[model samples]
Target: MRWAILRELAKGQSLPVVEIAKRLRTAPSAISKHFSVLYHSHIVNNEHGRYRIAPGLLSADRQSLDFGCFLIRLDRLPK
Candidate 1:
Protein backbone atom coordinates (compact mmCIF):
# COMPACT_ATOMS: atom_id res chain seq x y z
CA MET A 1 0.00 0.00 0.00
CA ARG A 2 2.77 2.40 0.85
CA TRP A 3 4.61 1.26 -2.28
CA ALA A 4 1.57 2.08 -4.33
CA ILE A 5 1.50 5.53 -2.80
CA LEU A 6 5.17 6.07 -3.60
CA ARG A 7 4.82 4.80 -7.15
CA GLU A 8 1.91 7.08 -7.88
CA LEU A 9 3.83 10.07 -6.56
CA ALA A 10 7.03 9.04 -8.32
CA LYS A 11 5.71 10.53 -11.52
CA GLY A 12 6.99 13.85 -10.16
CA GLN A 13 3.63 15.46 -9.84
CA SER A 14 2.01 16.97 -6.76
CA LEU A 15 -1.32 15.43 -5.89
CA PRO A 16 -4.05 16.23 -3.40
CA VAL A 17 -5.43 13.73 -0.93
CA VAL A 18 -8.64 13.28 -2.87
CA GLU A 19 -6.82 12.25 -6.03
CA ILE A 20 -4.63 9.77 -4.22
CA ALA A 21 -7.58 8.28 -2.38
CA LYS A 22 -9.40 7.83 -5.67
CA ARG A 23 -6.45 6.09 -7.32
CA LEU A 24 -6.02 3.72 -4.39
CA ARG A 25 -9.72 2.90 -4.16
CA THR A 26 -9.70 3.65 -0.44
CA ALA A 27 -11.38 6.02 1.89
CA PRO A 28 -9.90 9.47 2.28
CA SER A 29 -9.09 8.79 5.91
CA ALA A 30 -7.16 5.64 5.02
CA ILE A 31 -5.07 7.49 2.49
CA SER A 32 -4.63 10.33 4.95
CA LYS A 33 -3.10 8.02 7.55
CA HIS A 34 -0.61 6.68 5.02
CA PHE A 35 0.13 10.16 3.78
CA SER A 36 0.74 11.40 7.30
CA VAL A 37 3.21 8.60 7.88
CA LEU A 38 4.97 9.24 4.60
CA TYR A 39 5.13 12.95 5.16
CA HIS A 40 6.40 12.69 8.71
CA SER A 41 9.06 10.23 7.65
CA HIS A 42 10.23 12.61 4.92
CA ILE A 43 9.42 10.05 2.23
CA VAL A 44 6.97 12.53 0.78
CA ASN A 45 6.63 16.28 1.06
CA ASN A 46 3.39 18.08 1.49
CA GLU A 47 2.91 21.63 0.33
CA HIS A 48 -0.33 23.42 1.07
CA GLY A 49 -2.02 20.04 1.53
CA ARG A 50 -0.73 18.61 -1.76
CA TYR A 51 1.91 15.92 -1.64
CA ARG A 52 4.93 15.44 -3.89
CA ILE A 53 7.59 12.82 -3.93
CA ALA A 54 10.61 13.96 -1.98
CA PRO A 55 14.11 14.07 -3.38
CA GLY A 56 16.33 11.00 -2.89
CA LEU A 57 13.47 8.75 -1.88
CA LEU A 58 13.07 7.02 -5.24
CA SER A 59 16.51 5.47 -5.32
CA ALA A 60 16.79 1.69 -5.58
CA ASP A 61 18.30 1.51 -2.12
CA ARG A 62 15.23 3.13 -0.63
CA GLN A 63 12.75 0.75 -2.24
CA SER A 64 11.37 -1.29 0.66
CA LEU A 65 13.16 0.35 3.54
CA ASP A 66 11.08 3.46 3.48
CA PHE A 67 7.96 1.72 4.71
CA GLY A 68 9.86 -0.39 7.18
CA CYS A 69 11.55 2.68 8.60
CA PHE A 70 8.28 4.51 8.61
CA LEU A 71 6.68 1.78 10.64
CA ILE A 72 9.56 1.90 13.06
CA ARG A 73 9.15 5.60 13.51
CA LEU A 74 5.44 5.28 14.01
CA ASP A 75 6.05 2.77 16.74
CA ARG A 76 8.26 5.25 18.57
CA LEU A 77 5.68 7.98 18.60
CA PRO A 78 4.08 8.76 22.01
CA LYS A 79 1.34 6.23 21.62
Candidate 2:
Protein backbone atom coordinates (compact mmCIF):
# COMPACT_ATOMS: atom_id res chain seq x y z
CA MET A 1 0.00 0.00 0.00
CA ARG A 2 2.81 2.37 0.82
CA TRP A 3 4.61 1.53 -2.40
CA ALA A 4 1.46 2.10 -4.40
CA ILE A 5 1.00 5.51 -2.89
CA LEU A 6 4.64 6.40 -3.43
CA ARG A 7 4.61 5.31 -7.06
CA GLU A 8 1.52 7.32 -7.75
CA LEU A 9 3.00 10.41 -6.11
CA ALA A 10 6.34 9.96 -7.86
CA LYS A 11 4.67 11.02 -11.05
CA GLY A 12 5.43 14.49 -9.75
CA GLN A 13 1.92 15.74 -10.13
CA SER A 14 -0.70 16.45 -7.53
CA LEU A 15 -3.82 14.32 -8.00
CA PRO A 16 -7.40 14.53 -6.91
CA VAL A 17 -8.70 11.80 -4.62
CA VAL A 18 -11.28 10.67 -7.12
CA GLU A 19 -8.71 10.27 -9.86
CA ILE A 20 -6.43 8.27 -7.65
CA ALA A 21 -9.31 6.13 -6.47
CA LYS A 22 -10.26 5.30 -10.05
CA ARG A 23 -6.72 4.45 -11.01
CA LEU A 24 -6.35 2.15 -8.04
CA ARG A 25 -9.74 0.52 -8.68
CA THR A 26 -10.90 1.29 -5.20
CA ALA A 27 -13.67 3.27 -3.56
CA PRO A 28 -13.07 6.94 -2.87
CA SER A 29 -13.51 6.29 0.83
CA ALA A 30 -10.82 3.63 0.77
CA ILE A 31 -8.48 5.95 -1.04
CA SER A 32 -9.25 8.65 1.45
CA LYS A 33 -8.40 6.34 4.31
CA HIS A 34 -5.07 5.34 2.80
CA PHE A 35 -4.35 8.94 1.93
CA SER A 36 -4.97 10.02 5.46
CA VAL A 37 -2.56 7.39 6.68
CA LEU A 38 0.09 8.57 4.29
CA TYR A 39 -0.55 12.19 5.07
CA HIS A 40 -0.22 11.74 8.80
CA SER A 41 2.89 9.66 8.28
CA HIS A 42 4.49 12.60 6.49
CA ILE A 43 4.75 10.52 3.36
CA VAL A 44 2.37 12.92 1.68
CA ASN A 45 0.94 16.35 2.21
CA ASN A 46 -2.47 17.73 1.53
CA GLU A 47 -2.82 21.29 0.35
CA HIS A 48 -5.54 23.29 -1.33
CA GLY A 49 -7.60 20.15 -1.91
CA ARG A 50 -4.78 18.27 -3.63
CA TYR A 51 -2.01 15.98 -2.44
CA ARG A 52 1.70 15.73 -3.16
CA ILE A 53 4.41 13.47 -1.80
CA ALA A 54 6.26 15.10 1.06
CA PRO A 55 9.96 15.83 0.49
CA GLY A 56 11.21 14.32 3.71
CA LEU A 57 9.43 11.03 3.22
CA LEU A 58 11.42 10.24 0.13
CA SER A 59 14.82 11.00 1.54
CA ALA A 60 17.27 8.13 1.12
CA ASP A 61 18.16 8.53 4.76
CA ARG A 62 14.63 7.74 5.78
CA GLN A 63 14.72 4.36 4.09
CA SER A 64 17.84 3.41 5.99
CA LEU A 65 16.06 3.66 9.28
CA ASP A 66 12.82 2.02 10.33
CA PHE A 67 10.09 3.86 8.43
CA GLY A 68 7.88 3.81 11.53
CA CYS A 69 10.27 6.20 13.30
CA PHE A 70 9.44 8.96 10.87
CA LEU A 71 5.73 8.44 11.25
CA ILE A 72 5.69 8.05 15.01
CA ARG A 73 5.55 11.75 15.78
CA LEU A 74 2.72 12.51 13.43
CA ASP A 75 -0.76 12.66 14.85
CA ARG A 76 -3.45 10.43 13.43
CA LEU A 77 -6.00 12.38 11.46
CA PRO A 78 -9.71 12.10 12.15
CA LYS A 79 -11.61 10.04 9.68
Best by lDDT: 1
Worst 10 residues of 2 by lDDT: 70-79
* Tens-place lDDT digits, model 2, residues 1-62: 45565566666678878878877777888888889998887768888868887765544433
lDDT of 1 by residue, 1-79 (tens): 7767776676557999999989889898989999999889787898999998776555443333244354322222231
- Please provide TM-scores, in order, for all candidate models, with all chains considered together: 0.70, 0.67
lDDT of 2: 0.65
Give the Å error, residue 7, model 2: 0.8
Between which residue pairs do clashes occur in model 2?
Answer: none
Clashes of each: 0, 0
Weakest lDDT window of 10 consecutive positions for candidate 1: 70-79
**Local distance difference test scores for all models:** 0.72, 0.65
